[model samples]
Target: MQNTIFITGASTGLGKAAAKLFQSKGWQVIATMRNPEKENELNKLENVVVLPLDVSDSVQIDQIVKNVTNKYSVDVVLNNAGYGLIGALEALTDEQISRQLQTNLMGVIRISKAFTPHFREKRKGLFLNITSTFGLIGFPTCSVYSATKFAVDGFSESLASELAQFGIEVKVIAPGGMQTDFAVRSMEVGSHEAYEKLTAEVSKGYSPEKLANYTKVEDVAKIVYEAATDNKKQLRYVAGSDAIALYDERLKLGAEAQVANIKSMFTF
Candidate 1:
C-alpha cells in the first residue's frame, strides 16, 4: 500500500503544492482545506482526496480524524494550516490575538491529539509542523504570528523528545517568506494610520522577492517533502534564502545579537 500524507490548508500555497508533489511521488494525498468548495485542481488528480477542514474547529477535526483513520492509513500529518496577522501591536485586538493562537497553536495541538491514539497504536507516525523563520528570530511587526510559530517550535521540540520512544517522529519545517497567498490572502493586515509607515517598513523586509528574500511555495513544498522523508533524525528543516540566513545567524550570534543584527539592516 502507498504511504498516505494528510495535509491541512491544502487548498493553496505550500499545502496545495505539497499535495500535488506527494501525489506525483506515489503517495496517496488527503488534501484538506477550510473550504473544499474553493478547490478544483487538487480534486482532479488521481489518488488525491480533498476534504473540508478548519483547524480552529475541534468538532470537525475529531470527525475527520475518525473518518480518515478508519478508512485509510496515514503515514504523515502535515500541520500547515495557518495565516499571518500583520501590522502594529496596537492594531491587534484581543479577539484577533485569541484567534491567532487558537488557529495556529491550539489547532495543531488538538489535531495532533486526535491522531495520537492511532500513531501510538501503530507505534509509528510522523508530524511535520510548518513553522517560520519568525518562530526562531523575533522581528518588529509579527508579534502574534511569531508567538504562535514559536509555540509550535517549542511544542515540536518537546513532543519529539516525548514521542521518541513511541516510534513517532515529530519535526518542524521553518520556511522563510514564500511566493503565495500567504502574504495576501492568508494574512490579515491591521489598520492604524499611526503605524502605517512602520508597517510598510516591516512589510518590505518580509517580502520574499525584495532584497533577495526567501518565499517560494514550490521550494517550500520540496523542503516539506524532505522533512517528511529524510531519515537523519533531524528536528528542524528550514527553507528559503533569507530564512536560512536567519537560522544560521541565530546559531552564530545568540538571540539578542541576532535580533539587533536584523534590525540594523532595515531602515526605521
Candidate 2:
C-alpha cells in the first residue's frame, strides 16, 4: 500500500509544491486548503485528494481527522497552513495579534493534538511542521510573524522528545524567503510611520539577487518530502542560503549578539 500524507495549506506556495512532489513520488497526497473551491490545479493531479481545512478551526480539524483515519492510513501530517504578520508590534491590533498566534502557533498545535491519538495508536507517524527563517531570528517589521515561528521552533523540539517514545517524529522545516506570494498574498502589513524605514529596508531584503534571500518552492518541497520519509530521528531540517547564513551566525555569535547585530541596523 502507498503511504498517505496529509498536508495543510496546499492551495499554494510550499504546500502546493509539496503536494505535487509527493504525489509524483507515488504517495497518496491529501492536499488540504481553506478554500478548496478556488483550487483547480492540484485537484487535476492523479492520486491527489484536495480537501478543505482551516487549521484554526478545531471542530473542522477533528472532523477531517475522523473522516481521513477510516479511509486512508496517514503516515505523515504536514502543518503548513499559516500567514505572515508584518509591521511594528505597536501597530498591530488585538485582532491581528490573536489571528497571528492562533493561526501560526495555535493552529499547528491543534492539528497535531487532533492526530496524536491516531499516531500514538499506530505507534508510528511523522508531524512535519512548516516554520520559517523568521522563527530563528528577528526582523524589523516581522516581530509577530517571527514570534509565531519561534514558538513553533520550541514546540516542535519539545514535541519531538515527547512523541519519540511512541515511535512518532516531530520535525520542523525552517526555510528563508521562498519564491512565493508570501510578501504579497500571505502577508498582512500593519504600518506605522515610526517603522516605515525599517519596513522598506526589510522589503528590499526579499529581492531575487540581494538581501531578500529568496528560495524556490520546489526545493522546499524536496526537503519536506525527505524529512517525512527519510526515517531519520532528526528534529530540525533547515533550507535556503539565507536561512543557513543566519543559522551559522547564531551558532558563532550566540543569540544575544546576533540579535544585537540586527537591532544595530535600525535607527529606533
Candidate 3:
C-alpha cells in the first residue's frame, strides 16, 4: 500500500510543492488548507484530497482527523501551516503574540494531540514539523516569530524521544529563507517610532527580497520528502546548503558567542 500523508498549509509554498512530490511518488495526500474551495490546483491533482483545515480551528481539526482516520490510515502528518510575525518584543501587541502562538505553536500542539491516538493505536507513523533556522538562532524584528519556531523545535525534539518507544518517528525540517509567499503574507512590521532605527536595520538585514535570492522552495520540499520517507530519520534535518553552513557555524561558536556576533552585526 502506498503511504498516506496529510500536509497542512497545502495551498502554496513548500506544502504545495511537497503535496505534488509525494503524490508523484505514489502517496495518498490529504492536502489541507484554510479554504478548500479556493484550492483548485490541489483539487485537480490525482491521489490528492483537498480538505479544509484551519489549524487554529479546533472543531475543523477534529473533524479532519476523524475523516482521515475513517477513510485512510495516515502514515505521516506534516504540520506546516504557520505564519511569521515580525516586530520588536515591546512593540508587538498582545493580540499579535496570541495570533502567532495560536497558529504556529498551539496549532501544532492541537493537530499533534488529535493525531496521537491514531498513531499510538497503529504503533507506526511519522510527525514532521516545518520549523526554521530561527528556531536555533535568533534575530531582531523576529523575536515573536522566532519564539514560535523555537517552541516547535523543542516540542518536536522532546516528542521524538517520547514517541520512539511507540515506533512513531518525529522530525523537524528547519529551513532557512525559502522563497515563498510566507514572507509577503506572514511578515509584519511594528509601528513604533521608538524602535524605528532598529526595525529599519532589521528590514535591511533580513529582507525577504534578499533571502529569496538564495533559497528555493523546491529545496525545502525535497528535504521534507527525505524526512517523510527515510527509515533512519534524524531528529532534525536542516534544509538548504546555506542553512547547513549556518548550522555548522552556530555549532562552532557557542550560543553566547553567536549572540555576540549577531549583536556586533546589528551594532547593538
Candidate 4:
C-alpha cells in the first residue's frame, strides 16, 4: 500500500508545497485548510483530498481525525498550521496573544492528540511538526511566536519518548525565514509607540532584499519529506542555509554567548 500524509494549513506556503511534493511521490495527501472551498489547485491532484480543518477548534479537529482515519490509512501527520505573532509584549493585545497560542501551540497539540490513537493502533506512524529557527533561539519582536514554537520543540521531544514504545515517531522541522506569503498574509505585527525604534530594527530583517536571501518554501518541504521517510531516530531537522548558520553559531558559541550575540544585534 502507498503511504499517506495528512497536512494542515494546505492552502498556501510550505503546506501547499508539501502537498504537491508528496502527491507527486505517490503518497495520498490529505491536505487540510481552514477554507477548502477556496483552494484552487491541490484538490485536482490525484490521490490528494482537500479537507477543512481549523486546528484551533478541538471539536473540528476530532471530527476531521475521525473521518480521515476511518477512510484513509494515514502514515504521517504533519502539523504545519501556524502563524507568526510579532511585536514587543507591550505592543500586543490580549486577543492576538491568545489567538497565537490557540492556533500555533494548542492547534498542534490538539491535532497530535487526535491522531495518537490511530498511530498507536497501527503500530507505526510519524508526527512531523513544522516549528521555526526561533524555536531554537530567542528573538526580540518574536517573543510570543518564539514561545509557541519553542513549546512545540520541547513538546515534541517529550512526546517522542512517550510515543516510542507505541512504535510512533515524533519529529520537528525547524526552518528559518522563507520567501513566502507568510510575512504578508500569515504574520501579525502589533504596534506601540514606546517600541517604535525596536520594531523598526526588526522590520529591517523582513525587507525585500533580506527576505530574498531566505530559503524557498519548496526546499524546506523536501526536508519534511526526509523526516517522514528517513526512518531514523532523529528528533529535529533544521532546514535552510540561514537556519543552519544560526544553529551552527549557537553550537559554537554556546547558549550564553548566543544570547549576547543576538542582543548585540539590536540597540535601544
Predicted structure with the largest lDDT when compared to the true one: 4
Whichever of 2 and 4 has more TM-score, that candidate is 4
Task: Score candidate 3 by lDDT.
Answer: 0.88
User: Model 4, range 157-177, lDDT digits (tens) per residue?
Assistant: 999999999999999999998
Worst 10 residues of 3 by lDDT: 205-214
Candidate 3 structure quality by residue, lDDT tens digits, 59-112:
989998998998899999999999878877888899989988999999998999
**Model 1, span 1-268: residue lDDT tens:** 7999999989888999999999999999999999899787999999999999999999999999999999987899999999999767899999999999999999899889999888989999999999999898888778999999999999999999988899999999998878775677888878798878777777875565563444668888999998888786999998898788878888988888987886786656
Q: Model 2 TM-score?
A: 0.96
User: For every candidate structure, what is the RMSD over all alpha carbons to the true structure, in angstroms?
Assistant: 1.7, 1.4, 1.4, 0.7
lDDT of each: 0.89, 0.90, 0.88, 0.95
Every model's TM-score: 0.95, 0.96, 0.96, 0.99
Location of the lowest summed lDDT over 10 successive residues in candidate 1: 205-214
- In model 1, residue pairs whose N, Cα or C atoms come closer than 3 Å (at least 3 residues apart or on different chains), thus clashing, are 177-215, 178-215, 178-216, 179-215
Greater-TM-score candidate between 1 and 2: 2
